[model samples]
Target: MITDMTQGNPTKTIIKFAFPFLVGNLFQQLYNIVDSVVVGRFIGTDALAAVGSSFMIMNFFSFVIIGLCMGSSAVYSFFFGKKDYVSLRKSVFISFFSIGIFTIVLSILIILNTNNMLLLIKTPQSILEGSQDYLEIIFGGLIFVFLFNACSALIRSVGDSKTPLYFLILSAAINIVLDLVFVVEFNMNVEGVAIATVIAQAVSSILCFIYAFIKIPLIRLHREDMVFDREISTMVAKYSILTSLQQSIMTFGMVCVQGIVNTFGPDTIAAFTAAGKIDSIAYLPVQDFGNAFSTYIAQNKGAKNNERIHEGVKSAARTIIVFCLVLSTLIFINSENLMRIFVKANESNVINLGVEYLTIISVFYMLIGFLFMFYGYFRGIGALNISLVLTVISLGTRVLMAYVLSSIPTLGQRGIWWSVPLGWALADSVGLIIYKRLK
Candidate 1:
């Protein structure tokens, strides 16, 4: 199922890869979305808020793993494009073991300090215990999250996006079923959904690891390949650490914003949670397409197909603009209805707030779309520092503006909403200028 993007029409090949990746990303998002829905509908607003708040923290850690894996996969794709099988296998061994140890250490630290982390985020007392319980259970699955993302990244590096999608579909289905069984039948509350998510993640991670070893000969590590080379290790560290920092910093800013949102109490917290899920789902296609474009560019870069990479940038930009326009219209029109999905119709205040957040941000999807493309492009070309700089600009603006604008009495929470697109716009403008200069 491995594809060579260096040889195809850039637009067609990128879309072909992105379609499955987009679906897989959707299923991946479902792991969290279903948890919120089940907890919200079955438990209560407090429980929903608890899960939502804890999610921002959890997302911070999970994205660290994702960024590391994604960064390493660029190296994998480069080697694959060059037919450097020996070095590729060695990298697999190095990245797997190195990141695996890091995940273990991180899991223990996060688990032990769960309460303090929540407190630092200004988690209100009313939902503190629920958030702690949810987070503790979720932290136990960090290794699984690392494993699944690592395997998926490696698989996708060689253009086998469909394989990972299959596993995600299976796992997402299991997560939905388990969410119902545990929350509705057992009435386990927030803890129930958290446990369901962990179990589902375990399924996906274990299955993916097994599939990669048995089916992808390129990825299978032999005894000799297990020995690390200093050069490869250095390369992996440079790419992985920079990318991980970028991803974590981006989420960390959200955690900071979540702290601000926490100040508004549980209603705003719940509304933000629901609205955030809708926003992610709405823009996920363009985001995943950006990821696909990264893989395409990485392969072409390895093969020294500079002209094709330029064509891909143009092709991806056009596709993203059209897609964003359609998505913006759909989300803007159905904002209220989407809010109602995660919250009850009776919760008028929560629904209205969520609608407000969506209406303001949904119209600006193209800005984030371009930003994602730039992140992908820079990372693909081994410009990890550029990606990090762009993320800092984008997220730093968001966090600082969210605090400053939200503090003004007139702007209030609406200020927080508007700050997002403003950050995206600034980042996109900078990214476009940098890319042009690179060209």
Candidate 2:
């Protein structure tokens, strides 16, 4: 499964490797969007808002799992490039094992605080009970999220992005079918959506676990190969923890913004939720590419090719610009129709609010593209400090703007929407500075 990335045409190789990830990420997003769509249409807007308000919290831990797995994947990419299978497997096992332990405890703590946390986010009184039902189920299934990410990271680190995509498709299908059956047929609302997600994720995690252990020769560990290296663990931990903190910090800022949006009541929250899903899907292609670039850089870094890393970053930038231009244009023209994907006929205000948010965000889509590119570039090369600094700055800018702007009586809810681009602009500016100075 370990393909030689160091030998291929840089741009083609990067895109080829990243493409499955792009598709995989789309299916991944479907898991969330389908939930919103089903709940909004069948269960109503309040149910949709209940699920929406919890996105920041639900995703916070998911990001933690992803960041750590990403760090492990970096380690795997490095060692795989060096043909150091022993150390690669060891790091993989340790990371996989460690996150399993960590997520269980975290899940328990999160479940305990689910209600209070929703309260802190200012979830409306009407949506409170449904939010609790949804979040408790998600947090309890954190193990599925953690383990699947670990398995996928290890496999992809050795150049098998397609494998994960297969399982993602399987999971998406399962989640969609289950979403309909439980929510529509059984008259279950938020609980059905939550249960469907956990079940689908669990299946994917099991499949990934099976494939990695059976098909991937690199992961076929022996008793002797189980040597836990402290140095390797420490190094993996260094990258993983730092990246996790970076993601968590960014999510923390979004949670603050979610709190601001919540104050405007359920309709606005429902609107934000719907629009945010579209916004997330739009950014996903670049994220997958950024991740692809990271693996590309890690392997090439292991090969000692600094030039390829630079070339890859440039390649990623071109891809981002071209894609964003097209995507933003499409979204601008079809903003209303897109918003309708999650809102019903009666939810006209929700539709209008979503259109407003989507319009503002599209204008700065290119800026967001640049922001992701640098973040991906820095992360690929293990420029953890730089990545952390950019994310923190972006987070602070977003949080401050959310509070300061949204507090203005005139701006109110629109202020929450505008805060997004301001944060992105500031972050993009700083990231550009770093890229220019360093280059």
* The candidate that achieves the highest TM-score relative to the unseen native structure: 1
TM-score of each: 0.99, 0.98
Q: How many residue pairs clash in each candidate?
A: 0, 0
Candidate 1 lands at a TM-score of 0.99
Q: Write the per-residue lDDT of candidate 2 for residues 1-439, one digit (tens) a residue.
A: 5567887788899889889989988999998999999999998988998999988889887898788888788888888887888888888778877878888888889999999998888888999999999999998889999888888888888888899999999999999999999989999989999999999999999999999999987778878767678898898898899888888888888888889899999999999999999999987887788788888888988888888888877788888889889989988889999998899977899999999999988877887777777777777777877888888888888788878888899888888788888887888888888887877
Worst 10 residues of 1 by lDDT: 31-40
The alpha-carbon lDDT assigned to residue 294 of candidate 1 equals 88
Compared with the true structure, all predictions reach lDDT values of: 0.93, 0.87
Q: Which parts of model 1 are misplaced by more than 4 Å?
A: none
In Å, residue 168's CA in model 2 sits off its true spot by: 0.6
